[model samples]
Target: MTPIRHNHSDGDAVLDAVRDCVLAVGVRRTTMTDVARRAGVSRMTLYRRWPDVRSLVGDLMTREWVAAATDAMPERRPGTLTRDLIADGLVAGVAAFRAHPLFHKIVDVDPELLLPYVLDRRGASQEALLALLADVLREGHADGSVRQGHVERQARALLLIVQSFALSLRTMTDADDTELNGDAFLAELRGILERTLTP
Candidate 1:
């Protein structure tokens, strides 16, 4: 695979294609050739850009997850507290992720694809979210609305909490039991985030 000589501008089309492919038939069944055919690009072109299906799917996940996180962020008003914004954003972010079709497809059909990210290493999307979180935490610190601490560390901790709720909350949720349903746990998450960020 000629990994270093591809055009980045073609990423949108490629990502869109891979997203459709994966959604139609989970990552395990998706092939590099399928992505190329869906993207209307040559197989050689795809090979030049991505070594395999997993890498292509990785980029697609990064794109879609970042979009969800960005959309979940509340607009900052003059009197809005930064910590409150963060708390709201974190809760909203988890909700968005849980609602994402791509996330659901991967979790339902290709959960093994996530094991490496969950147990072994952070993915590009996680790093992007962490940077976004750190920047917002810095803003909160500047406004005296968040607890003082290393921004990266705080972001990482918050991410750990978010990941649990976003990825695995359903496993413990009891839709038949109102006390432990998804919404209840989301409320708990919001409370935990607020307490963690309170100065």
Candidate 2:
């Protein structure tokens, strides 16, 4: 499949520059002038598109997150259980977040900027994720694989669980006594989802 592109022409370049800048010096220190210079666009052009670095970073995060979620979606099969499909998608989504080169940088360097999306009420990224999962749950309901319930509620619960796991990785213990590695954690999460969805 052709790769999904979030921005148009120079916008793409600008977001790329923003990503590079954020990774290099963090969100606080990345300047519009620096992004303009890196993107080979005039400062005036950058200003026309974004009023400040925070807005620019918000757009960048949205674009990157949409792309990541799109790429992480699992292929739907006729007889697949709803829980299994959601579990697979969650695993892929979490893996995408984990594998992103800038994820750790943002978490370690500019976590405050990300707190609104993860800690507080729903943000653009969270809304997008909920919509995606809602669609999946709706499909499962149509196919008789999902229980009869409020799809939005199910979607919200799924999103919260997956988001918690993804954002709380740094806080997870790595003690040898606890099996909290990627595979084990995902397996546990999958089982939990299965039980939650079972009717």
Q: Write the per-residue lDDT of candidate 2 for residues 1-199, one digit (tens) a residue.
A: 1234543778888999999999999999999999999999999999997999999998888888878877876776666676678777777788788778778788889889988876666777777777878887886787676676898999998888888778886577476636635667777777777777666
Candidate 2: TM-score? 0.89
Candidate 1: clashing pairs of residues? none
- Once fitted onto the true fold, the runs of candidate 1 whose alpha carbons sit more than 4 angstroms away are 1-9, 179-181
TM-score of 1: 0.93
CA shift at 199, candidate 1, in angstroms? 0.6
What TM-score do all the candidates reach, one by one? 0.93, 0.89
Instruction: Please give the lDDT score for candidate 2.
Output: 0.80
lDDT (Cα, 0-100) at 111 in candidate 2: 84
**How many clashing pairs per prediction, in order?**
0, 0
